[model samples]
Target: MKKTITFLTVLLVSINMYAQENLDLLTYAHTQDINFFNSIKNGTQVKEYITVSKNSVKIGDTLILGTPTSEEMSIRTYSGSYGTKARGGVAQSRSTSKKTYEFIQMGRPAGFGSIMAAMNGDAASMADNSLKNTTVIVNEIKTYHRGSKNKPLYVVMVLGELNGKAFGINKYLSVMDTELAVESGEILLKNRKMTRDEAIAKLKEAKELMGIDMMSKEDFEALKKELAPIITYKNQE
Candidate 1:
């Protein structure tokens, strides 16, 4: 009886530890600061790692960097894809027609390399050319109850800071908010939530939309495929 009790106690303790690990990611994501990675790595030649574990509550997933010793962040993921054209995601306007659509919060990255440096937390350092920073742009966060290969999981991206910085760095995990809505002509014609046809309709309806005339045809199509999953949650609503 004593042995059995000891085993149960150990199991409980293990479960608690696992829960704590998961909570750590959510906490860090909720409150990431400039100095978040000070403890994780230095300018050393070691490997850093980041891993994601599923969770509810828009917590998204966690990214851990470092070898045996890992530094992690609680990050969210969002996807946007073009409709039946099934070409996947296409570039659209930053604004959504629906006021309650998902939310995107961005942090100015000091540099691209800086972001990677921060993510790797000193695990690995890149060349000076690789260091660049830009305003971290967020598009979508896809949450799934269970995994499925057919569905595009999720895709999160950031526009690399242009000639301004050498590289973009991961500073804070942006929390994205999203929702569903009926077709509207007011929102940007090319938002993540709109399908290709819908976007075309909007363009014909409203030429004044900001992002519509910006991207080249090739760039626009690529954008569609890449961002296809940003609005995955639209189906849920």
Candidate 2:
């Protein structure tokens, strides 16, 4: 009787602890929806990212960079931004521009290596060159906001070299946020000129996100509308 009671108590405690781990994360994704296959059939698009799980990732893990577009979800988290210092994240514009510089998020990096040094200083403004059209292999993955929140918004903040020059990057953790940052080997078209299969794959990814509550139905619908024109491109599916 004593042994059984001890085992039950331990099991309950372990389950509770596991639940707490997901709570530590703060994402706009509601993560409750479950419909996945239909979205692909309906024609979405594919966005590849390295899957990030608290259980699998560790400090000092290396993340390869990718090309970044305005549509990319990886919002840049700087030291002084309200998003960086506060709980949750800072407000970001959907169609970001050079004027705002508010969310200098990235998809892929250019060849510039001063991303970190400039970001670490006062009144730092990122130049267009900071986002060079190049890829890199970096060796830093430290927590961004390690205060009341232990996880760093699921984005990768890396510090490594570009031709022996050090740089820094902080962005949202959507697909391709980093090469090894999430599920690998999936590719999504950045714009409207995607192949038939690519378009379907991308929408499928969005649908899955909505099902899991990671995305809202409204956004998913918007994506469908956005890609509607492509469904009838030359090479019909």
Q: What would the TM-scores of all predictions be?
A: 0.18, 0.27
Q: Write the per-residue lDDT of candidate 2 for residues 94-191, one digit (tens) a residue.
A: 44344212223332221122233333452333323344333344333321121223223223333343455433443322222332322221212122
lDDT of 1 by residue, 139-179 (tens): 21222111222322122222223234423343432321111
Q: After superposition, how far is residue 81 of candidate 1 from its true place, in Å?
A: 53
Best by lDDT: 2
lDDT for model 2 comes to: 0.36
Superposed on all Cα atoms, model 2 deviates from the true structure by an RMSD in Å of 19.2
Candidate 1 residues lying further than 4 Å off, grouped into runs, are 1-103, 108-152, 164-196, 199-237
lDDT agreement with native, every candidate: 0.29, 0.36
Task: In angstroms, give how far residue 45 of model 1 lies from its true place.
Answer: 21
